[model samples]
Target: MPTTPAQPPVFTQKKLPLLRTEELMLNMGPQHPSTHGVLKVVLELEGERIMKATPVMGFLHRGVEKLAEDGTYHQFIPHTDRLDYVCAMYNNFAYVRAVEKLLDLKVPERSEYLRTIVAEVQRIIGHLFWLGTQALDIGAMTVFFYTFREREFLLDWFDQLCGARLTTSWYRIGGVERDVSQDLIGQLRYFMKEFPPKIDEYNVLLEKNRIWIARTKGIAIISAEDALSFGLSGPTLRGSGVEYDLRKAEPYGAYDQVEWSVPIGVNGDTYDRYWIRIEELKESSKIITQCLDKLPEGPIMADVPQIVAPTKDRVFTNLESMIMQFKFFSVGFPMPKGEIYCGTEAHKGELGFYIVSNGEGKPYRLKIRAPSFIHMGAFDHMSRGYMIADVVTIFGTYDIVMGECDR
Candidate 1:
């Protein structure tokens, strides 16, 4: 009774609310499992929903661009291989394309055909890597092994062409370093025939699996409008139902002659994007088949002897060939003024390079527009109200590699 009387007196004395407002900031990464790379996502959580998210990058920064500023034009080729390490050929192609544009150099017809074959093969490998890892992220185990097995075959082909498996500095400004062997062509033809069935195997494993559908079908959906606005490209953009591809819209590297379909998704969801990439693998195989069938017979390199190094036999036997090699190695060819941005539908998306030349051997300025960086910007918007588990699925769908993002 005494306690009840005291409580009433306290209410008369003035009572205050027990609750207060505060913003809860949570650090999801820099070390978390779901970030995929050295990505740190700072999230603001209000109960089960995320109010805001901030991505902190540069943890994998290697000063690669600045390093290029110091090295010679030819010396920087290996460095470009590291930029988008997954698909080193794409990075090599992009940089050399910019340099070639600067020089106004024409690649031999045979070389152009060869480049197409290699790039499309690389696209297959890159997409396969993405599919395997993405499926694993969503808890599909056997699909990972199947995807990697196919990827290993491509890497073996790469090893056969270039001494190294990855980081092939095979492309030069004027043309390729060497010609493609008949053996390589035979192997590629074999891969083209064998790859489609493997893709079907992966589809059977996870494409319609109940668990996969529940996890990815409607989760982290992005409409086509939002995708284009957010600068999404490659499978990410196509998955959202946009039928735009650099290869189809603005064909490069013998793409104009090759016939293939550009796959589109009905809804901009994870599943659609998955389907888009799977379809792209088929289309890329078609392009490879056409290339092997029509590979021209001629010099793999241009007849510009001064620009390209002479063969080992010529280097030893001919004095003139030796002297030309010395000049080309010591003083690189001069590039023209003005800038050009050449883009290709890379494994990630629209990988473009804007190169400026002040009539110098080295680039005045080289700016790379990586697609993963653009796709990452949409993370906060896509994941605002989703559960913590949805983070992995959404991130996997974007297929961000730190090498490309930091580059």
Candidate 2:
């Protein structure tokens, strides 16, 4: 029995199979096309799923806030154009509104209606740009072409209004740069009639698409509480079902006179955000139409000779008017020795300007609450657990323009 006891089988480490595991590191861009601009994202991936995302900004930073300190109130108007270059008129509107608020200036009633109509037109152009780019990012080539076609019409209209399409520095502190011509009004009226059908075409192309639905329906969701915590606004905030629109909550520029509803979404997904922008396009058109109908006959600029620039005719003929215009351009009108913050409902979100004055022509301190920058703070929260490919969808969902974000 003792001889029958055999040696036990020896265990060998080499015979057991080994499992390998590691997290992948990926740099999404400072140059990636889908990034929307010079944005770089450091991503930690676990089997193609995003575990963490850290956004690296400043690639496009030109110290815009610092630049604001070096210029007069009137001189700074053109600077805002580069912030959201896609919708430059809105940038102009938001900036001048802030400056006017600081001065306690009153804009003429006709100017308010003009501002509202132009702003809504800018909204439609912005939404079209967003829709086309977003659909293009999601592999829907047809929609990009279709949306841009409509967008070109609006851009042409902008050229007619301001003589510059992309960076139209047409808004003034006390009012707009000029009055809208009757022909321009006719063009807008025609666009209002023709654009609704084009929106329907976009819906037909993307709404029923299986790929688009699958990519966006449940992706990049954040609750209403979370969105508010992240300081989201405009369509991004409304996409989470929050009924906070500055146009309605705090009326300015004929918005109180017009009637239109804010579009809200149930689920805070990318698709819901897309839907919100589409609905906003319709609402913006309605706002513009109502504004035109109620457009008044009065002065476009305020009659504050001390603050506003003189008319071209006055500057040409009157020596005092010429001197005032020269002084206004060289040294800006003095602001009160205080600080003020003003926010406007831009297409992307609430574009805000906070200024500090020392009774000087130039702002002592200036800060911009850019929504692209704010929305980026929520990127990691929204992007986690999503597949790698969904990152582009998330970027487009925010309608991000790094000109604003990096500034």
Candidate 3:
């Protein structure tokens, strides 16, 4: 009976296994709206936070470099238009400047000033396009319309300057395709006068908007060292406070003759890049104005008979000039057996061309240092730890165009 006495029940707690989670893989583009082009990004995400990003390029690859090898130097100017098609003039300018360096050609003084003016106009157009599209991406709709409104004017001016608006092959190897008429100059001067306030209007819409500030500030930050290491140029590099601009550093065109300052940012974030571009719009306007006021009177094309095309009047009137034109376009000019790399300050970044010549018309080897492609190299580095939503902003911040990226 004592042994059978009831004993208190004993209790034990059971341990549960820890929950295991798997990361997610997301294909953001090649079709998605925000990729900026036929760009595909493989994002490894953990609950809406991006862990890694891999850019899948070549969707728009047209083997542009190979094409450069197949054609004459003069024939390739239009091809450069297809790369960064949004800002074709800069591409043309960069490519021609590279070819000129290889040929050791000297552009006329008037041609230099003209090239600078048109280039700055192209710069403003580029910045406007960037601002509009970028603001639209960030949920600010009004800014888009405003920026594009001004952009339309410049594009129309482009049409007047060169028959084409988007893919204008207005740049020549030693100079420009044609001189800027007085009427175009007058219109551009008017645009310069009106463009500053319009930039302010864009700022008014997003500069103080709480949502835009929250979205852009403290996002996608890169230091000056990293920027340089990554070979970032233009506003992207300047946003990191690096004051290296080919226009000023190398003094190409009339950049040295102009009195304008490069904008530097204290914090290398999306906001800083945006701010830098905004300031650049103003500086571009100032540059255009000065270049116009001091526009010299001379021939637009270099006097290199072999490389430069003869004037239309001469081509029509003189039998020898007609034959020369035909030969220049057909067989192309002979280049010395050498290699050269020339970097130009394009809208997106440093648009460089490294060409190897074999005493032939076509390039033996051609390489393009496209900013969109180079900037993509740093995408995974910059996008780590940011939210998935921030990817679009990062893309716009780079002002990426896949036309050049995949090429």
Clashing pairs in 2: none
Local distance difference test values of all predictions, in order: 0.81, 0.90, 0.88
* Lowest lDDT 10-residue stretch of candidate 2: 1-10
As for TM-score, the candidate ahead, 1 or 3, is: 3
> By summed lDDT, which 10 consecutive residues of candidate 1 come out lowest?
1-10
Better of 1 and 2 by TM-score: 2
User: Which lDDT tens digits does candidate 2 get at residues 1-407?
Assistant: 01112122222233235656579999999998877789999999877888899999999999999999999988888899999999999999999999899999999999999999999999999999999999999899999899898889989999999999999999998999989999999999999999888899999998879999999887888889999999998888888889999999989999999889988887888878899898999999899999999999999999898889888999999999999998999898878999999999999999999999999999999999999999999999989888899999999998999999999
Which predicted model would earn the best TM-score? 2
TM-scores for all predictions: 0.91, 0.95, 0.94
Q: What is the lDDT ranking, best to worst? A: 2, 3, 1
Maximum-lDDT candidate: 2
Candidate 1 TM-score, C-alpha based: 0.91
Following a full C-alpha superposition, what root-mean-square deviation does model 1 have from the true structure? 9.9
Candidate 1, 1-407: lDDT as tens digits: 00111010111212247756466888877886555568988878765556787888988888877776655577778988887888998888877777776667788888889999999999999989888988888788888899999999999899889876788888887788778788989988998998899889998998679998888776677778888999999989887768889988987788888788998887677777888888889999999999889888887777766456678898799998888777656665566788888887897899888877777666677778888788889988787777667778888898888888888
Whole-model lDDT, candidate 3?
A: 0.88
Q: Please provide, for model 3 over 244-359, each residue's C-alpha lDDT reduced to its tens digit, 9 standing for 90 to 100.
A: 88888888998998899988786888888999999898888889899999989988888889999888999999999999999999889999999999999998999999999999
- Candidate 1: residue 307 lDDT (0-100): 54
